[model samples]
Target: MSTICLYGSASGGIDRRHVELAATVGRLIGERGHDLVYGGGGTSVMGAAEAAARAAGARTTGVMPRALMEVELPPEGLGELVVTDDMRERKAEMDARADAFIVLPGGLGTLEELFEIWVARTIGLHTKPLAVLDLDGHYAGLRTWLEDLVARGFARPLAFEVVHWGADPATALDHLESAPRERISLPSSEILGSFADFPDDRRERP
Candidate 1:
């Protein structure tokens, strides 16, 4: 069985629909007999998903940063929990463990994780399939911006081709299942040239 890593919010203030969506996705993952890997938190969207997946009989693993333990307490009953010294280590551990990735409604942190994985895929670092569940058009704006970047010559066609999107969990899972297990081969120049240019002073602003 594949181990699906889910990136999503850990905030209790998010919309109820998003919470329900997370739970449903988790349940579906379990029902499909796949394992789950996610941020280890006992509250909000991540917590809800973990809970549902475990209840449905899926093996659940959580990767968390040591520093966030107090704030994002590790949930009870995880089959495995890996705590890292920092966020980077936490992300690395999750990446090494997952066979595929799913993006759910979340905040900036989730977006960061998704982008990092997308870049890794573009560079042929891994062949795992990545998908975004665009529930209620949550990712519509981001998709438009990506396409616009390609149109403006800031990104290559491969950049957009690296990602897949679905309107619901089952569709997302199906896409992942059908994806090839071999890494995509791209010329080194294309990979190196895909990065968008940024002003040197951009980081100077706050």
Candidate 2:
């Protein structure tokens, strides 16, 4: 019954193995009766995942920045579409809607989403579970780097342990479902400033 947010590549004409992996994840989400929210791109991993999820009877939502409308096309018949004023807003919307997060194989944009959410969780911004789908050793180097950070004392071991890594979709989902939500002792106002103090979503012009 949880709403899972998926982060992955939106580019077209990529490797077929990655595309199948995305589809498999989507199918499992549907079969497990979990809903889905994603970046709302209609190509490659993004599109394949949503399409498979919808086909398997999962309710799917797509969140996108209005600015990217010209650059990315959301799949047709997406259950719902939410347009945000900026990338930050889009991510915020997804964060609020999702109970868990799963990252598929992707490129730079995917990595950006992963680190932002991972850091936010480390700081107690949210306690939801997060995982990365490490298909065919795709994320082996990144995993090594994260471990190195912990070993070097650049990152806390607790923070590093929260990120569950799985080579397959089912194992990833299992970890997410079983992971406990962390309780933060920090005050809400201290962790998150007042809404009034938040900057406007629109970009400033010189």
Query: What is the alpha-carbon lDDT for the whole of candidate 1?
Result: 0.88
lDDT, candidate 2, 41-134, per-residue tens:
9899999999999999999999999998777798889999999999999999998999999999999989999999998888878899999988
Candidate 1 C-alpha lDDT tens digits along 50-143: 9999998899999999898888888878999999999999999999999999999888999999999998998789999998988899889998
Give the Cα lDDT of each candidate: 0.88, 0.89
TM-score of the candidate numbered 1? 0.90
Determine which window of 10 residues in candidate 2 has minimal summed lDDT. 197-206
Q: List residue ranges in candidate 1 displaced over 4 A.
A: 188-206
